[model samples]
Target: MSLPSVLLRLVASLAFATLASSLSHAQSGEPGCRPEMAGHRLPIQRVQLAKDEVRLTFVGHATFLIETPGGVKIATDYNDYVRPPVTPDIATMNKAHSTHNSRRPDPAIKQVLPGWDPAGKGAAHHDVTLGDVRVRNVPTNIRSYEGGTDYDGNSIFVFEIGDLCIAHLGHLHHPLEPGHLRALGRVDIVLFPVDGSYTLDQEGMLEVLKSLQARVMIPMHFFGGGTLNRFLARTQELWPVERREQPTITLSKAALPTKPTMIVLPGH
Candidate 1:
C-alpha cells in the first residue's frame, strides 16, 4: 500500500529518532549494545568542530567551563568562588549552597539558567538550544537549613553537544531515585561533587554513581587531598581513578573509555 508523503516523512523521522537513541546507548557499552566508535581517544587540542570535541575546564568547586565545537561556551554551577577567564555564553546555577550560585552574575552572559525558581515553582524546567549545544536540567531536592529537605532546590544540568551527553551534578544532596535517572538519560561524561561533608557522603555518592553509570566521571567540589583520597579509595574496587594534571580535557563520543572511570582534575 502506498502511503501519503506526509505520513512517509513522519515514519522516517520516527525511525531516525529510534536509531539515534539506540546508537547513543550503544556508545556507552551498556547491556547488549554494540557501537562503532566506542573506545577511541580523540586528539588533545583546542576546541574544533573538525574533531567533534568539546573542552571542559575545572574552574573550582562545582563550576566547570564547557566549550563546544560550535563556539558556544557554558559555565556549570557558576558562582563567586572562581569565575571563568572569559564570560560564558550560558551559565547554569544551583542555589543549594552559597558556592553553587551567585546572586549577581555578569550581565554579559547571554543565558543564565538558575536551577531553582524564585517564584516558588516546584521545579525549574529548562530545555534551551543555543548554537550547537542543548542545555537542560533535572531538578533534585536539597538539604534545607532547618534540617529538613527542600524540594527542587538543585539541578543536575545536562549538556548535549556533538553526540555527547555531559551532566554536572550540582550540590547533589542525596542519592538519585529512579525518576532522576530516567530524566538524566544516558550520560557520557559527568562532573560530580566529591566533597563528603558538603555534598553527599562517600556511601551516598557511590549510590548515585551506581544509578547514573556514566563512562567518564570528573570529580569536583573537593576541598583537600585527604578528602579526595578517601573518595578514590572507595572507587578502587569498581571504578578506576585517574588523576589529570591539567585542568582542561577535550572529549568526543569516539574517545570514551569502555569501563567507568573516575578522573580527577586539580582546582579549588
Candidate 2:
C-alpha cells in the first residue's frame, strides 16, 4: 500500500476507537476522553525579546528549552530527568517511548502538547505557531519486537524558530523514506540519537542527516563510552564538528551554519 493509504487506515482506526471509547464511557456514566483540543492548540505565552540573543538551554538528552528572538520559550521532549529542569512557556512530548513523554511536567509551563495530537478531528497534522516561531511534527515508524509490524504512527518533531528550523528525531528506529523527507520540509539543525540501541544506529543516523541536509547536527542519547566519538567521526568526514565548552549554546538564524556542521554540547 502507498504511504498515504497506510496513514489513512491508521487514522481511521484511531478515529473509530476514539468514538467507541467515547460511547462506552457515556454508557458507563463517566466523561469520555475529551476530544483533543481543536487544531490541538497549545497555550501561548509572551516574552520580551532582548536585543540579539536567542538563548537555548540543553536540558540533557533530547530535551531543549529554546528562547526565540521574539521571547517565546519552547521545550522539546521535556522528560522528567533533565537536571536543573526548566519550566518553559511550552513543552512538546512524543508518546512513543516512556523517556520522551511525561504525564507530570513542570506546572509553570503555559502549554503542553503531545506531538501526535491532531487538529479538526482527523489524525493530527503537526503545525503549531507561537509568537515568531513555528513547530511541526513528522510521523515515522518504530520497529516492533516479536516480528510484529512497525509502529508507523510514531512521530519525529521539528521546530522552526525565527530563521532556524530544528528537528528532533524522537526514538527513530529506521531511515527516512522519500515521503518522510517531504513531510519534514526544511531543517536547519537536527537533534539525533547516536546510542545505536534504542534508536537508529550511528550509520542510519548519518543517512538521515545526508537526506535532510541540515546545517547543524547535534548528537543526543549517547550512553557515553566511544559511541559519541564514533558518531562524530562518521559525520566529521562530511561535516565540521564544534565541541562546545558549555552544556548550552545560543544562536540566531543568521548565525546558523551554511554547510553541514556538528555542535557537541556538554551533558550531565
Candidate 3:
C-alpha cells in the first residue's frame, strides 16, 4: 500500500534471486565442470544425422573408442586389453579392478582421467573439453577385495558432443544414487556392463538401464557367452535387441530410438 514498502520488497526479492543464481553456478562449477551442458539445438527433417554424428567403437572389456565429428577421439576404461592403436585425445578409466583401470597409460595422450585416486581417500572429479567433445565423470563406491568398501572406486564417464550425450558405466558395482542421476542428466547412448557378478547383476543392471532411459543401450564387460546370452533373453521380451556383426555404431540426435534398444557389438 505504501511506496517505500513496495520499493523495499522489490529490492529484497532481487537480492534473493541473485543469491539463488550464485548458488546454482557454484554447484555446477565452471563451464566444463558440469556434464548437463546445453547448447544450441538444430532441427533436421526425418531421423537422419545431417552433420553432427559420433562413432562408438567397442574396444573390449568396457572400453569404447568414441570418435567425434570434430576429430576428437576418446577411449573409455583404457586398460591394457584391446586399446586403440592410435593415441586418443582423451581417456577415462575406472578403479573397480585391474582390468577396468590402467596402471600405465600412454604419456602421449592429451588427457587421462582416472575414475578414482590411487590413495583411496576421496572421489574423482573430472570435467574437461577436448576439441568439440566434453568429458565429465560421476564417481561411485566399489566393493573392496578384502570384503571392505572403497569410496569413489568407479566412475560413470559422460561424453557430450554434437548435442548428444553418451555415458560409459565404467565397472559400476552398484545402483546409481540420486546425485549420480542428476549429474548424468539425459544420456542418448549408454555403454553398460552386463556381467552379473562383476558389475551390477543382470536384474539390477536392467534397473539401472530403466532409470537412465537412454535411447541406445550397448552391453559390454560380460565374461562369457552364458552371461551375455542370459542378459539378452531377459531383455528381449521388453526392449528391442539388435546384434551387429561389426564393433562400431554411429549415431546422432535424430537417430536415437524412440524406445530403449539393446545393441550388442560383436567383440564382447
Best by TM-score: 1
Alpha-carbon lDDT, every model: 0.84, 0.72, 0.82
Error of 3 at 131 (Å): 0.7
The TM-score-based order of candidates, best leading, equals 1, 3, 2
Question: Where does candidate 2 clash, by residue pair?
Answer: 118-124
Per-candidate TM-score against the hidden true structure: 0.81, 0.74, 0.79
Off by over 4 Å in 3: 1-50
Q: How accurate is candidate 1 locally (lDDT)?
A: 0.84
Writing each residue's lDDT as its tens digit, candidate 1 over 194-266 gives 8887678988998888888899999888888888888889889998888899998888888888889998888
Q: Report how far off residue 91 is in candidate 3 (Å).
A: 1.0
Give lDDT tens digits, candidate 2, residues 68-152: 7777778777765552233577787754356676768778777777765433232336577877777778766566766554554
> Which ten-residue region of model 1 has the weakest summed lDDT?
33-42
Candidate 1, residue 112: the lDDT equals 94
Best by lDDT: 1
Q: Count the backbone clashes (under 3 Å) in each candidate.
A: 0, 1, 0
